[model samples]
Target: MVKGIIAYIVTDGNGQDAVKFYEDALDAQVLSLQTFGDMPENPEHPTPPEAKDRVLHAHLRVGENELMLSDTFPGSSLKLGDQVGIAVMISTPEKTKDVFGKLSIDGLVTMELQQTFWSPLYGQVQDKFGVTWQVSTLTQDE
Candidate 1:
């Protein structure tokens, strides 16, 4: 049985930047940061020299949520799109607006925050790291 599900992001070489962005945008705290070089060398799982400085693992506390991420393995890449989205249910419209505004700064806003049939305030945006977010105010009936 699973205890919980933590959103994990894999970037080509932007995991560090993503962690910093989340820390600032969501006011999240970085619990742990590890680089590939921090790991012990293994014959079957060797760490590439060029990838040594990349993020091997990162753990963050986004508000009360847990988020983990890592830079892709050597010779790998990342592509973002509508495949997945991280949804945030805040306690107030103010937070929804604030988070949306911060995350949408250098990205795209597909929906403006406003009163919706299902929520008091709801919006969708793609942050600078190419991560899509759905910010909304938690409702009673949800």
Candidate 2:
């Protein structure tokens, strides 16, 4: 099973702008970039052409962890608040299941575990103390 901390999501009103700022200010590298409309293989994913310029995914290396950036989908009510849940991305189905099960105990399941086009396993839950988590198992060929 694959094991590693992939990255942390940083939501921003201007994702590309924020990434650019961080790249310049912190001397960070833009390891990879993926635009919403430019997503390969899945044509029915609903990423509008207008969002082609918006960052769907981006990676900037800072120390040991990669800081991921993504623009909020147009019309999405979700916004970055004072409290943000750190996503724990696993890379295998086994790990995802294990983590999900452990977290589910005494925790509230915000989103039940399910397979997504983007990942093999994905789920969200709030632990007993109310800390939110986003867990995923890599299905991306990369």
Candidate 3:
């Protein structure tokens, strides 16, 4: 069984200017910034020299949470759509609902607050920047 929380899915984009934007806007500290060229074990990956500058793995510290950001490798297809959204699961329904409402100011609300079969409170929205988000409060039974 899964014993630990490794990471969460936030946004999977081209991530061209995302690193700088996140660092500035969120005041996030980059813990580890690595690139494709830095990984020596994957020699067969065939990463171009220029692409080495692209972010392979970046850990950003935001408040109490560590947000990760990375760029998709060449030839990898990870497109954004309505079905896919960055899920942010909070511990409490109050905070989760508040965040959902705050993020929905200039965003679109695909789903309103309601009790899910798995969680106590659940909602979905797309932020102003075209990033989708799913806010949920996990129940003890889940």
Candidate 4:
């Protein structure tokens, strides 16, 4: 089952600044914030020292709605129009796979569904309409 969807804002490297701006402008309450530096070490891929302070993910409550923010991986950039995306929160791995498969039809798969430190099942896809979706199964911690 699908749980919910949230608007995800991607910043090139100004996530912290953006968070502050939103907090003041929208009176958003930050539910949680995690930075690249908080990720577990992996021999295959390491977080760049410069990117350590960048937000990996941040969840904020604006009024009664939710807003999420994150900084792009080091070396990546987002053109102004491409800074936003939709995140789908699923309740189960099966539902996640089903939704991911449907979203990938005639669409570009940016990241194949796979396990990561944050999610047991997660992937990114740009649908036919050019809307990006990040599908993830919710963990207890979330």
Candidate 5:
């Protein structure tokens, strides 16, 4: 049985930095940050020097949601854009505007935040980190 689903992001080497960005921009609360260097040394499993500074794992709390992140493991490629999009349902229009303003500062706005038939406020943007988001404030019917 599936209990929950969490959004996990993989970055080339900027996973830690992305966590900081989300903290500042979306007020995401950082739960934990572990680096490759933090892993215990094992004779069988060796850690590479270059990966020491990369993020091993990170957790964050954004409003009522949670996100997991890590740098693409050594040798693995991290692909950005055209993959997945996060959809956020905010409480109010003001919050939607504030979030949109912050995320779109250095990002590309796919859709301007405006009143829609389904939602009072709706917008789509791809953050500077290449993460896509759909921010919306629901209407009375919702």
Candidate 6:
């Protein structure tokens, strides 16, 4: 089952600043914020010093919808205009895989569906129309 769709905003390196701006400007209430430094230390892939302070994920509530934000890792290929994407929250890993596979048919699969620290199933794809989508199963907290 599809839970909800969220607008995810990605910043180059100043996600904290953007969060503050939205808090004041749009009166968004931040539910959670995690920086790259907050991630569990993975010896194989260390968090770059420049990205340690960058937001890995932020969840905010505005009106009745959800607003998410994050920062690209240092030296990532994410461009300014492509920073905005849609996140499709699914109810189960099975449903998430179905949706992700369908979305990746003619689109580019940026990240294959796989388990991550935050979700049981998570992936990213850019549709044929060029809109990026992050598909994932909702976590317990979500």
Q: Please report the candidate that would top TM-score against the real structure.
A: 6
RMSD of each: 13.2, 3.3, 10.9, 1.1, 13.8, 1.0
Per-residue lDDT over 37-137 for candidate 6, one digit per residue giving the tens place of the 0 to 100 score: 99999999988888889999999999887899999989987875788999999999989989998898889999999999999899999998888999999
lDDT of 2 by residue, 89-113 (tens): 7777888889888888998997899
Better of 1 and 2 by TM-score: 2
Whole-structure CA lDDT of model 4? 0.94
Show pairs that collide, candidate 5.
none
lDDT of 5 at 110: 81
Q: Write the per-residue lDDT of candidate 3 for residues 7-124, one digit (tens) a residue.
A: 4333344454776787799897877777766666555766777567666667678777777666666655566553234657677888887888898999899789898554698777
Report the poorest 10 consecutive residues by lDDT, candidate 1: 1-10
Flag regions of model 6 displaced more than 4 Å: none
lDDT tens per residue, model 4, 52-77: 99999999999989999999988987
Q: Give the TM-score of candidate 3.
A: 0.47
> All candidates' lDDT scores?
0.77, 0.73, 0.67, 0.94, 0.78, 0.92
- Model 4 misplaced regions, further than 4 Å: none
Q: Tell me the TM-score of each prediction against the true structure.
A: 0.53, 0.72, 0.47, 0.95, 0.54, 0.96
Best by lDDT: 4
Error of 4 at 22 (Å): 0.5
Error of 2 at 57 (Å): 1.4
Q: Flag the better candidate by TM-score, 2 or 3.
A: 2
- lDDT by residue (tens digit), candidate 5, 9-97: 66788887888998999899998898988887777978988888899768799999888777866887656554345667777898889
What does the lDDT come to for candidate 3? 0.67
Angstrom error at residue 31, model 6: 0.4
Per-residue accuracy of model 1 over 1-142 as CA lDDT, tens digit each:
1124456676778778988998999899999999988887789978879888899778799888888777876886456654346767677667677778898999999788888655798787888898877677877654
In model 1, the runs with Cα more than 4 Å from the true position are 79-142
